[model samples]
Target: MTINLTEYGLKQTIQKTITATEQPRLGRVIEQHRELYQLITATGQRQAQVTGKLAHQATSATAFPAVGDWVLFSAGDDYTTLIDRILPRQSVLARGAVNQHDGQIIATNIDTIFICMSLNADFNVRRVERYLTIAWDSGAMPVLVLTKADVCTDRADKLRALADVTVGVPTVMCSAETGEGLEDLQPYLTAGQTVAFVGSSGVGKSTLINRLLGATVLATKTIRQDDDKGRHTTTSRQLLPLPSGACVIDTPGMRELQIFVGDLQQTFAEITALAADCKFNDCTHTSEPGCAVQAAVADGRVSLERLQSYQKLQREMSYQGLNSRQLEQAKIQRMFGGKQAMKRVKQRYHRD
Candidate 1:
């Protein structure tokens, strides 16, 4: 039952950790079902649960091992394994937890993220932008995948709409039914690479993964004819290997994607660049005079819709439980000299 660890993206860094540790064996988490986990090692797949010490040390859900995390474990007596430690993640995709200030880990150690959206009734440019922000901040490349292209009549228009927001990010039009644009994803699906598919329900993430795996490994449900919304078929995160030697993590559909810790500047680069030319250092861009962002909107360089989207995401990030004082100080430091920046931030807080 032993399998090659290389197919699961075992690298020198993980090997070093394994070599350094003596008591625990190395394994990669393949599936997560609440507190239960399924890990794959050189021996084979085994059911696992985190050790009591590991659980007690976790302050939040994000601190626990996620589907793509590599961990140290020990064999238990009854065909179970005890996960002792989680190795450092190379990259992580996380988002703000629902109604909570803490972050939720979507997948860890992912090399690439596929932000899938159906070109039908489920398509939304703003949601895609939110996914891109988290993906960019995750230290992984984000590739936009437009699914159900066979049903969409206005593919060109939809691509045009995504052009300004997506910018340099690559977009691939795919149809699981017709196998279109599946081959274009091969470059990112190379052997030993891990990719996670994320989007709302009915976006065909499971279907796309099935097509890539060349088997119906993940369950999928039909979309409702009225709203085009599909039921949640994949209830939990699971990493499955493809015939191509790459691994794909299929996640449950996220209905609402709140901002976690991500770089707004990177997500909205066009607006960030424009802000540099603003008349005031702290121009809010709403009604500020000499606002480069507004000017661009007026001059047709930046769309009003895009600017509004940027402003909305900025507001979301601002209130996502990150230290407000630190955020202000960082902004001031970016605008003024160090000491003067701290002084200005204090004065601004005092004024408010």
Candidate 2:
């Protein structure tokens, strides 16, 4: 008798690389430990594991398969067969690795990125600009989803601000409660297509997904009145198959986003384009004789905050070297930048 992988939800499915172990096995990554990953095979759903060699070879997070990635792997009855290779990705959503100076894969093979933001205190055009740069660098199309439109006093004003920041990207305003503008999402979420949501918490990610699903597969929560930030409701990354023959991956809210140094230029296309007009080949846009970038900023063509954010990310990534010591320092700084004064006081007391 022949076994069919589809029956077991193990057929042609998108899965993330979890881990690779060599002591007891010799295969690569087939499943991930990210908890939110679901694997499909020719037979049915399968638990994924990896071989040790790939684990040893992974120098960065991007080297591993992220959510929305399709990989080929063998299967055993108990654990999944070791992964042999990661299939080609159509699109990827990545951010700078936390503490490490490398690029981390947020999700892979994404066809579209839903840039969600709330209409309340959570809205920040600077943040949207930062995200757009990374999204443009990721080789994926970005779609801005402004949620909580019902709460906003003037929806048009809020959307116009977002439109100004995102330039060429398509922006949509939707209220999960009223299902307003939900139909606008259908063009991208067609059958066999994959879409991923990238935004901070309290942006109505789960609420929107629940609306898209026509049911409540994902949980939703209310944000605190003071902070206007979601309660980090979606803790892990998980992909769900929508009834409309599309797939969606929802991830946890990120507080701070760092950009990979190598991709900064690609992400900031406007700056790079403007730099071409610079008189000097290596214009820093500060005090250069013919700095087109600075000229644009001066002329109000480019926002000063946007350029500064780009430069800030570049410097942060540059300082975060690949070495272990640099990585440790970056981690500590990221986790404790706000409490450095108190930290120093405590350290001095302990030493005394």
Candidate 3:
């Protein structure tokens, strides 16, 4: 029953200086299935649900108890616990369609995100770029893990295809079945670290995680030859402890999300940097005479595909044709790119 919360990434700062709360229990959410939650507390794993008050006050799905979220709860009965508060998250992965105000939270407080895509037909560099945008924006380090190494031919060409979008990102190629090249993932799974694996359905996220866990805790379906995508096997988000003393949160097959403006800027940092050198501040990279991004594309510094991907994301999020309210949101993201940046802004405001 008794478990070490520290082993599950209970931050030292929260354990030390946080003031007392009305809630008597502290727990980490390890699994969630729609309305139901399974948590790890000092006593044991408890089935929990959020109080109506908590749900009422929650402005968005991002505020709810997601896998990897820490919550304060109290026993509602022998069978259930009532979650009162979801602790502040250091990092969060959220997704939604274009123009959505309250995007869905995928996971929270994660240290790293393993964006998996099969090296076979399921691999798409643009999709990787989209995942990278969300991962970079989530305040977690993004690592590209290419699964199904055994099935891949023309590996060099595939790797080359990924080069532009995956610049400065850690990438490892391995076959989940053969266990080849998984060793490269060990350095990220050190004690106390929490990594989240995310990709579309049947990209071998479960297979890869099962191999890492040394057991088949999660079910994996064979990849469909017709679509070349994995079957939708993982339905709920669950955090499992790795044998290496780290934890990993595996999510279900994900849909492509509308890009976050801040994430887009980070994901295409090279293009953003190039844009800064443009003679005209508002130069669109398309056919603009003074656009440095286009110049880079022309001169081989930036791949045209990467630029097109960036532009497409911009269009998806309405950044290119932003209205007044959307423009304000863009400004906010530029000012507060992440939580750390937001904190700095607040500190400066107080000082002023």
**Number of clashes recorded per candidate:** 0, 26, 1
* Model 2 lDDT at residue 254: 85
Tens digit of lDDT per residue, candidate 3, span 1-352?
6788777877753443234553248889999988989998877798889998989966555566888887788767565689987765667787664456656678888999999998877888889988888788777899999989999988899998887788889999999989899999999999889999999888899989999999999998997778787778998899988888899999989755566433777788889988999988888888778888888888999888888988888776534567668755544443233355456545654554
lDDT-best of 1 and 3: 1
Considering TM-score, which of the candidate structures 1 and 2 is the better prediction for this target? 1
The sequence of per-residue lDDT tens digits that candidate 1 reaches over residues 1-352 is: 7788889987764565444454238889999888899999888898899988989976566768889998889867776789987766668788888766556789988889999999998888989889998888787899999999999999999998898778889999999999999999999999999999999987999999999988888899989998888788889999988888889999999888888666677878999999999999889899989999999999999988888988888888734444768755433322222444346445654554
The estimated TM-scores of all candidates read 0.88, 0.77, 0.87
TM-score of 2: 0.77
The segments of candidate 2 whose C-alpha lies over 4 angstroms from its true place after superposition are: 1-37, 76-80, 261-267, 317-352
Please give the RMSD to the true structure for each candidate, in Å. Answer: 8.5, 12.6, 4.3
Highest-scoring model, lDDT: 1
Which ten contiguous residues of candidate 3 have the minimum total lDDT? 15-24
Q: Tens-digit lDDT track for model 2 on 17-134?
A: 2222421221212235652234554444556654566567555556566676666666455654665445445456767766675567677666788999889889898788768766
Measured with C-alpha atoms, the lDDT of residue 76 in candidate 2 is: 53
Model 2, position 144: C-alpha lDDT score: 91
What is the C-alpha local distance difference test score of candidate 2?
Answer: 0.67
* lDDT to native, each model: 0.83, 0.67, 0.80
